[model samples]
Target: MIDRSQLQTVLESDFLERSFPVFNSPGIKDEDVMIHSLGCSVWNTLGHELGFMAVVEGPAPIASGNDIRSDSVWFDKADNTPLVLIEFERYDGTDRGYGKLEEKLGNLMEASMRWGDQPTLLVLSAWSPGLVSAPDFERLELMFRRGFSNSKGAKIPAPTNCQLLLHRLVLSESHTGLLQLQRMNFRWS
Candidate 1:
Protein backbone atom coordinates (compact mmCIF):
# COMPACT_ATOMS: atom_id res chain seq x y z
CA MET A 1 0.00 0.00 0.00
CA ILE A 2 1.12 3.58 -0.71
CA ASP A 3 1.74 5.85 2.22
CA ARG A 4 -0.83 8.56 1.63
CA SER A 5 0.61 10.79 4.35
CA GLN A 6 4.12 10.68 2.92
CA LEU A 7 2.80 11.19 -0.57
CA GLN A 8 0.82 14.17 0.68
CA THR A 9 3.90 15.62 2.33
CA VAL A 10 5.87 15.36 -0.91
CA LEU A 11 3.06 16.94 -2.88
CA GLU A 12 2.65 19.74 -0.36
CA SER A 13 6.35 20.50 -0.19
CA ASP A 14 8.25 23.46 -1.72
CA PHE A 15 9.39 21.32 -4.62
CA LEU A 16 6.94 22.87 -7.09
CA GLU A 17 7.63 26.42 -6.02
CA ARG A 18 11.36 25.86 -6.19
CA SER A 19 11.35 23.94 -9.47
CA PHE A 20 8.60 25.55 -11.56
CA PRO A 21 10.32 28.92 -12.10
CA VAL A 22 11.92 27.40 -15.19
CA PHE A 23 8.54 27.50 -16.89
CA ASN A 24 8.42 31.25 -16.52
CA SER A 25 11.88 31.81 -17.93
CA PRO A 26 11.93 33.65 -21.24
CA GLY A 27 12.13 32.08 -24.76
CA ILE A 28 10.95 28.52 -24.10
CA LYS A 29 7.81 27.42 -25.91
CA ASP A 30 4.83 27.12 -23.52
CA GLU A 31 3.66 23.94 -25.19
CA ASP A 32 7.01 22.23 -24.85
CA VAL A 33 8.08 23.47 -21.43
CA MET A 34 6.34 20.76 -19.41
CA ILE A 35 7.44 18.03 -21.79
CA HIS A 36 11.05 19.20 -21.68
CA SER A 37 11.61 20.23 -18.06
CA LEU A 38 8.85 19.22 -15.63
CA GLY A 39 9.80 15.55 -15.57
CA CYS A 40 13.34 16.23 -14.45
CA SER A 41 12.16 18.57 -11.72
CA VAL A 42 9.66 16.04 -10.41
CA TRP A 43 12.29 13.31 -10.58
CA ASN A 44 14.71 15.39 -8.52
CA THR A 45 12.05 16.41 -6.01
CA LEU A 46 10.91 12.85 -5.47
CA GLY A 47 14.49 11.83 -4.86
CA HIS A 48 15.10 14.61 -2.35
CA GLU A 49 11.75 14.23 -0.64
CA LEU A 50 11.57 10.43 -0.56
CA GLY A 51 15.10 9.12 -0.94
CA PHE A 52 14.37 7.29 -4.17
CA MET A 53 16.64 7.51 -7.20
CA ALA A 54 14.88 8.94 -10.21
CA VAL A 55 16.20 8.82 -13.78
CA VAL A 56 14.92 10.91 -16.67
CA GLU A 57 14.41 9.60 -20.21
CA GLY A 58 15.34 6.06 -19.18
CA PRO A 59 15.51 3.48 -21.93
CA ALA A 60 13.23 0.42 -21.79
CA PRO A 61 12.22 -2.21 -24.32
CA ILE A 62 8.55 -2.61 -25.17
CA ALA A 63 6.83 -5.70 -26.50
CA SER A 64 5.29 -3.87 -29.42
CA GLY A 65 8.49 -2.35 -30.79
CA ASN A 66 12.15 -1.61 -30.23
CA ASP A 67 13.25 0.12 -27.03
CA ILE A 68 10.68 2.80 -26.24
CA ARG A 69 11.34 5.67 -23.87
CA SER A 70 9.97 6.69 -20.46
CA ASP A 71 9.75 10.20 -19.07
CA SER A 72 11.20 9.08 -15.76
CA VAL A 73 11.80 5.95 -13.68
CA TRP A 74 12.09 5.91 -9.88
CA PHE A 75 13.60 3.16 -7.78
CA ASP A 76 15.75 2.32 -4.78
CA LYS A 77 19.35 3.41 -5.26
CA ALA A 78 20.69 0.28 -3.59
CA ASP A 79 18.79 -2.52 -5.33
CA ASN A 80 17.76 -0.68 -8.54
CA THR A 81 14.38 -2.38 -8.79
CA PRO A 82 11.92 -0.02 -10.50
CA LEU A 83 9.37 1.48 -8.10
CA VAL A 84 7.71 3.79 -10.57
CA LEU A 85 7.47 4.58 -14.28
CA ILE A 86 6.22 8.09 -15.02
CA GLU A 87 4.74 9.56 -18.21
CA PHE A 88 4.20 13.28 -18.75
CA GLU A 89 1.79 15.16 -21.03
CA ARG A 90 0.49 18.67 -21.66
CA TYR A 91 -3.18 17.88 -21.87
CA ASP A 92 -5.48 20.60 -23.16
CA GLY A 93 -8.56 18.36 -23.07
CA THR A 94 -8.14 17.33 -26.72
CA ASP A 95 -8.30 14.05 -28.61
CA ARG A 96 -4.53 14.07 -28.93
CA GLY A 97 -4.18 14.16 -25.17
CA TYR A 98 -6.42 11.13 -24.85
CA GLY A 99 -4.45 9.33 -27.54
CA LYS A 100 -1.22 10.08 -25.69
CA LEU A 101 -2.63 8.60 -22.49
CA GLU A 102 -3.56 5.40 -24.32
CA GLU A 103 -0.12 5.05 -25.84
CA LYS A 104 1.64 5.62 -22.53
CA LEU A 105 -0.55 3.10 -20.73
CA GLY A 106 0.45 0.51 -23.32
CA ASN A 107 4.11 1.26 -22.76
CA LEU A 108 3.67 1.03 -19.00
CA MET A 109 2.11 -2.42 -19.30
CA GLU A 110 5.13 -3.67 -21.20
CA ALA A 111 7.53 -2.04 -18.75
CA SER A 112 5.85 -3.64 -15.71
CA MET A 113 6.87 -7.07 -16.95
CA ARG A 114 10.41 -6.36 -15.74
CA TRP A 115 9.36 -5.87 -12.12
CA GLY A 116 7.93 -9.32 -11.31
CA ASP A 117 5.73 -9.24 -8.19
CA GLN A 118 6.64 -5.80 -6.93
CA PRO A 119 4.18 -2.99 -7.59
CA THR A 120 5.31 -0.09 -9.78
CA LEU A 121 3.85 3.39 -9.66
CA LEU A 122 2.44 4.54 -13.00
CA VAL A 123 2.33 8.31 -12.82
CA LEU A 124 0.77 10.61 -15.42
CA SER A 125 2.03 14.13 -14.95
CA ALA A 126 0.16 16.85 -16.81
CA TRP A 127 -1.15 20.41 -16.58
CA SER A 128 -3.79 21.32 -14.01
CA PRO A 129 -7.00 23.39 -13.93
CA GLY A 130 -7.49 21.53 -17.21
CA LEU A 131 -7.64 18.17 -15.41
CA VAL A 132 -9.11 19.66 -12.21
CA SER A 133 -12.59 19.66 -13.58
CA ALA A 134 -14.40 16.58 -12.27
CA PRO A 135 -15.73 15.18 -15.53
CA ASP A 136 -12.50 15.44 -17.47
CA PHE A 137 -10.49 13.79 -14.70
CA GLU A 138 -13.05 11.02 -14.41
CA ARG A 139 -12.88 10.41 -18.15
CA LEU A 140 -9.14 9.94 -17.95
CA GLU A 141 -9.57 7.52 -15.05
CA LEU A 142 -12.02 5.48 -17.09
CA MET A 143 -9.57 5.23 -19.97
CA PHE A 144 -6.93 4.00 -17.53
CA ARG A 145 -9.09 1.10 -16.45
CA ARG A 146 -9.93 0.21 -20.05
CA GLY A 147 -6.41 -0.31 -21.32
CA PHE A 148 -5.47 -0.78 -24.97
CA SER A 149 -5.71 -4.04 -26.92
CA ASN A 150 -2.87 -5.81 -28.71
CA SER A 151 -2.35 -6.37 -32.46
CA LYS A 152 -4.15 -9.67 -32.10
CA GLY A 153 -7.30 -7.80 -31.06
CA ALA A 154 -6.98 -9.37 -27.62
CA LYS A 155 -7.15 -7.05 -24.60
CA ILE A 156 -3.92 -6.61 -22.67
CA PRO A 157 -4.33 -7.03 -18.94
CA ALA A 158 -3.80 -3.88 -16.96
CA PRO A 159 -1.11 -4.21 -14.33
CA THR A 160 -2.59 -5.15 -10.97
CA ASN A 161 0.68 -4.21 -9.28
CA CYS A 162 0.53 -0.69 -10.65
CA GLN A 163 -0.81 2.42 -8.91
CA LEU A 164 -1.62 5.52 -10.92
CA LEU A 165 -0.97 9.05 -9.72
CA LEU A 166 -2.10 12.08 -11.68
CA HIS A 167 0.22 14.95 -10.90
CA ARG A 168 -1.17 18.19 -12.27
CA LEU A 169 0.76 21.43 -12.45
CA VAL A 170 -1.64 24.30 -11.90
CA LEU A 171 -0.24 27.33 -13.71
CA SER A 172 -0.80 31.02 -13.06
CA GLU A 173 -2.94 33.24 -15.29
CA SER A 174 0.06 34.38 -17.35
CA HIS A 175 0.53 30.69 -18.18
CA THR A 176 4.20 31.15 -17.35
CA GLY A 177 4.23 30.45 -13.63
CA LEU A 178 3.18 27.64 -11.33
CA LEU A 179 0.20 28.38 -9.12
CA GLN A 180 -0.17 25.04 -7.37
CA LEU A 181 0.75 21.37 -7.54
CA GLN A 182 -2.22 19.05 -7.46
CA ARG A 183 -1.98 15.32 -6.78
CA MET A 184 -5.01 13.24 -7.57
CA ASN A 185 -5.37 9.54 -6.80
CA PHE A 186 -6.15 7.12 -9.64
CA ARG A 187 -5.96 3.34 -9.59
CA TRP A 188 -6.68 0.44 -11.93
CA SER A 189 -9.10 -2.25 -10.78
Candidate 2:
Protein backbone atom coordinates (compact mmCIF):
# COMPACT_ATOMS: atom_id res chain seq x y z
CA MET A 1 0.00 0.00 0.00
CA ILE A 2 1.18 3.49 -0.81
CA ASP A 3 1.54 5.64 2.30
CA ARG A 4 0.22 9.18 2.49
CA SER A 5 3.64 10.53 3.29
CA GLN A 6 5.07 9.06 0.12
CA LEU A 7 2.47 10.74 -2.04
CA GLN A 8 2.73 13.95 -0.03
CA THR A 9 6.47 14.10 -0.42
CA VAL A 10 6.20 13.61 -4.16
CA LEU A 11 3.66 16.40 -4.57
CA GLU A 12 5.45 18.89 -2.32
CA SER A 13 7.59 20.05 -5.23
CA ASP A 14 4.49 20.53 -7.35
CA PHE A 15 2.63 22.87 -5.01
CA LEU A 16 4.35 25.99 -6.37
CA GLU A 17 4.04 25.05 -10.03
CA ARG A 18 0.40 24.11 -9.63
CA SER A 19 -0.85 26.97 -7.45
CA PHE A 20 1.13 30.00 -8.65
CA PRO A 21 -0.69 31.34 -11.73
CA VAL A 22 -4.19 31.13 -10.30
CA PHE A 23 -3.20 32.62 -6.98
CA ASN A 24 -0.80 35.25 -8.28
CA SER A 25 -3.28 37.20 -10.35
CA PRO A 26 -7.01 37.63 -10.88
CA GLY A 27 -8.12 35.55 -13.79
CA ILE A 28 -9.96 32.33 -14.51
CA LYS A 29 -8.02 29.12 -15.04
CA ASP A 30 -8.97 25.99 -16.94
CA GLU A 31 -9.48 22.82 -14.98
CA ASP A 32 -8.61 20.58 -17.95
CA VAL A 33 -5.33 22.42 -18.49
CA MET A 34 -4.42 22.07 -14.85
CA ILE A 35 -5.22 18.38 -14.91
CA HIS A 36 -2.98 17.83 -17.92
CA SER A 37 -0.17 19.79 -16.30
CA LEU A 38 -0.55 17.78 -13.13
CA GLY A 39 -0.33 14.57 -15.13
CA CYS A 40 3.00 15.54 -16.60
CA SER A 41 4.38 16.63 -13.27
CA VAL A 42 3.21 13.54 -11.44
CA TRP A 43 4.64 11.18 -14.01
CA ASN A 44 7.89 13.06 -14.33
CA THR A 45 8.30 13.12 -10.57
CA LEU A 46 6.95 9.71 -9.63
CA GLY A 47 6.51 7.57 -12.71
CA HIS A 48 9.70 5.58 -12.37
CA GLU A 49 9.57 5.36 -8.61
CA LEU A 50 6.05 3.96 -8.69
CA GLY A 51 6.02 2.49 -12.17
CA PHE A 52 2.76 4.29 -12.95
CA MET A 53 1.99 6.32 -16.07
CA ALA A 54 -0.17 9.34 -15.45
CA VAL A 55 -3.10 10.06 -17.73
CA VAL A 56 -5.30 13.15 -17.94
CA GLU A 57 -9.07 13.14 -18.48
CA GLY A 58 -9.11 9.46 -19.23
CA PRO A 59 -11.83 6.84 -19.12
CA ALA A 60 -12.77 5.69 -15.65
CA PRO A 61 -13.88 2.30 -14.37
CA ILE A 62 -17.58 2.17 -13.58
CA ALA A 63 -20.10 -0.61 -13.21
CA SER A 64 -22.35 0.76 -15.92
CA GLY A 65 -19.42 0.81 -18.39
CA ASN A 66 -20.21 4.26 -19.57
CA ASP A 67 -17.71 6.77 -20.91
CA ILE A 68 -17.19 8.62 -17.65
CA ARG A 69 -13.99 10.60 -17.39
CA SER A 70 -11.49 11.24 -14.61
CA ASP A 71 -9.28 14.29 -14.32
CA SER A 72 -6.17 12.24 -13.64
CA VAL A 73 -5.33 8.58 -13.39
CA TRP A 74 -2.03 6.85 -12.77
CA PHE A 75 -1.94 3.40 -14.29
CA ASP A 76 0.32 0.59 -13.15
CA LYS A 77 2.79 0.02 -15.94
CA ALA A 78 3.07 -3.65 -15.27
CA ASP A 79 -0.60 -4.49 -15.00
CA ASN A 80 -2.33 -1.54 -16.67
CA THR A 81 -4.52 -1.06 -13.62
CA PRO A 82 -5.44 2.31 -12.28
CA LEU A 83 -3.54 2.88 -9.06
CA VAL A 84 -4.22 6.55 -8.50
CA LEU A 85 -7.35 8.49 -9.39
CA ILE A 86 -7.80 12.25 -8.95
CA GLU A 87 -10.38 14.93 -9.62
CA PHE A 88 -9.24 18.52 -9.83
CA GLU A 89 -11.23 21.73 -9.44
CA ARG A 90 -10.51 25.43 -9.13
CA TYR A 91 -13.16 27.17 -7.09
CA ASP A 92 -13.74 30.91 -7.47
CA GLY A 93 -13.52 31.90 -3.80
CA THR A 94 -12.66 30.41 -0.46
CA ASP A 95 -16.29 30.34 0.63
CA ARG A 96 -19.27 28.78 -1.22
CA GLY A 97 -19.04 26.84 -4.53
CA TYR A 98 -18.97 23.56 -2.68
CA GLY A 99 -21.54 22.10 -4.97
CA LYS A 100 -18.92 21.87 -7.66
CA LEU A 101 -16.57 20.18 -5.23
CA GLU A 102 -19.26 17.73 -4.22
CA GLU A 103 -19.68 16.79 -7.83
CA LYS A 104 -15.98 16.14 -8.18
CA LEU A 105 -16.00 14.00 -5.06
CA GLY A 106 -18.83 12.02 -6.54
CA ASN A 107 -16.75 11.49 -9.62
CA LEU A 108 -13.87 10.22 -7.56
CA MET A 109 -16.22 7.95 -5.66
CA GLU A 110 -17.45 6.38 -8.86
CA ALA A 111 -13.96 5.72 -10.17
CA SER A 112 -12.82 4.24 -6.88
CA MET A 113 -15.84 2.03 -6.54
CA ARG A 114 -14.91 -0.05 -9.56
CA TRP A 115 -11.20 -0.28 -8.95
CA GLY A 116 -9.97 -3.72 -7.94
CA ASP A 117 -8.39 -4.33 -4.56
CA GLN A 118 -4.96 -2.81 -4.54
CA PRO A 119 -2.92 -0.06 -3.03
CA THR A 120 -4.80 2.91 -4.45
CA LEU A 121 -5.22 6.59 -3.75
CA LEU A 122 -8.47 8.38 -4.51
CA VAL A 123 -7.66 12.09 -4.62
CA LEU A 124 -9.68 15.29 -4.79
CA SER A 125 -7.67 18.45 -5.21
CA ALA A 126 -9.68 21.68 -4.97
CA TRP A 127 -7.69 24.82 -5.48
CA SER A 128 -8.87 28.08 -3.94
CA PRO A 129 -7.45 31.59 -4.12
CA GLY A 130 -7.00 31.95 -0.40
CA LEU A 131 -6.89 29.54 2.49
CA VAL A 132 -10.13 27.80 3.34
CA SER A 133 -11.67 28.61 6.70
CA ALA A 134 -12.19 26.07 9.48
CA PRO A 135 -15.89 25.76 8.80
CA ASP A 136 -15.33 25.34 5.10
CA PHE A 137 -12.74 22.67 5.66
CA GLU A 138 -15.08 20.87 8.03
CA ARG A 139 -17.78 20.89 5.41
CA LEU A 140 -15.38 19.51 2.81
CA GLU A 141 -14.46 16.62 5.07
CA LEU A 142 -18.06 15.93 5.93
CA MET A 143 -19.05 15.82 2.28
CA PHE A 144 -16.33 13.28 1.52
CA ARG A 145 -17.29 11.05 4.45
CA ARG A 146 -20.90 11.08 3.44
CA GLY A 147 -20.21 10.22 -0.17
CA PHE A 148 -17.60 7.59 0.66
CA SER A 149 -19.91 5.53 2.85
CA ASN A 150 -22.86 5.68 0.50
CA SER A 151 -21.00 3.92 -2.33
CA LYS A 152 -22.13 0.33 -1.99
CA GLY A 153 -19.69 -2.62 -2.25
CA ALA A 154 -16.74 -0.28 -2.27
CA LYS A 155 -13.40 -0.93 -0.70
CA ILE A 156 -13.56 -0.20 2.98
CA PRO A 157 -11.12 2.63 3.57
CA ALA A 158 -8.32 1.99 5.96
CA PRO A 159 -6.33 4.83 7.52
CA THR A 160 -3.05 3.52 6.13
CA ASN A 161 -4.29 2.40 2.76
CA CYS A 162 -7.15 3.17 0.38
CA GLN A 163 -8.82 6.47 1.27
CA LEU A 164 -10.22 9.66 -0.17
CA LEU A 165 -7.53 12.31 0.02
CA LEU A 166 -9.11 15.75 0.20
CA HIS A 167 -6.62 18.51 -0.45
CA ARG A 168 -7.14 22.26 -0.31
CA LEU A 169 -4.61 24.28 -2.23
CA VAL A 170 -4.51 27.97 -1.45
CA LEU A 171 -2.26 30.96 -1.75
CA SER A 172 0.50 31.43 0.77
CA GLU A 173 0.10 34.16 3.35
CA SER A 174 2.01 37.39 2.99
CA HIS A 175 4.47 36.37 5.65
CA THR A 176 5.08 32.96 4.17
CA GLY A 177 5.82 34.60 0.82
CA LEU A 178 3.64 36.54 -1.56
CA LEU A 179 1.78 34.34 -4.08
CA GLN A 180 3.33 31.11 -2.87
CA LEU A 181 1.70 27.69 -2.66
CA GLN A 182 0.17 26.41 0.55
CA ARG A 183 -1.51 23.05 1.05
CA MET A 184 -3.57 21.33 3.72
CA ASN A 185 -3.36 17.77 5.06
CA PHE A 186 -5.79 15.09 3.87
CA ARG A 187 -6.76 11.44 4.33
CA TRP A 188 -9.98 9.65 5.13
CA SER A 189 -10.88 10.37 8.72
Candidate number with greatest TM-score: 1
- TM-scores for every predicted model: 0.72, 0.64
Best by lDDT: 1
Residue-by-residue lDDT tens digits, candidate 2, 23-78: 43343343345533643354344544555677767676546544557777777777
lDDT assessment of candidate 2: 0.58
Candidate 1 accuracy as lDDT: 0.59
Candidate 1: give the clashing pairs: none
The TM-score that candidate 1 achieves is: 0.72
Q: Considering summed lDDT, which 10 consecutive residues are worst modelled in model 2?
A: 150-159
TM accuracy, model 2: 0.64
lDDT of 1 by residue, 77-128 (tens): 7788777777776656567766666677666655655355254677766664
**In model 1, where do residues sit more than 4 Å from their true spots?**
1-4, 23-35, 61-64, 128-135, 150-155, 175-189
Error of 2 at 184 (Å): 4.8
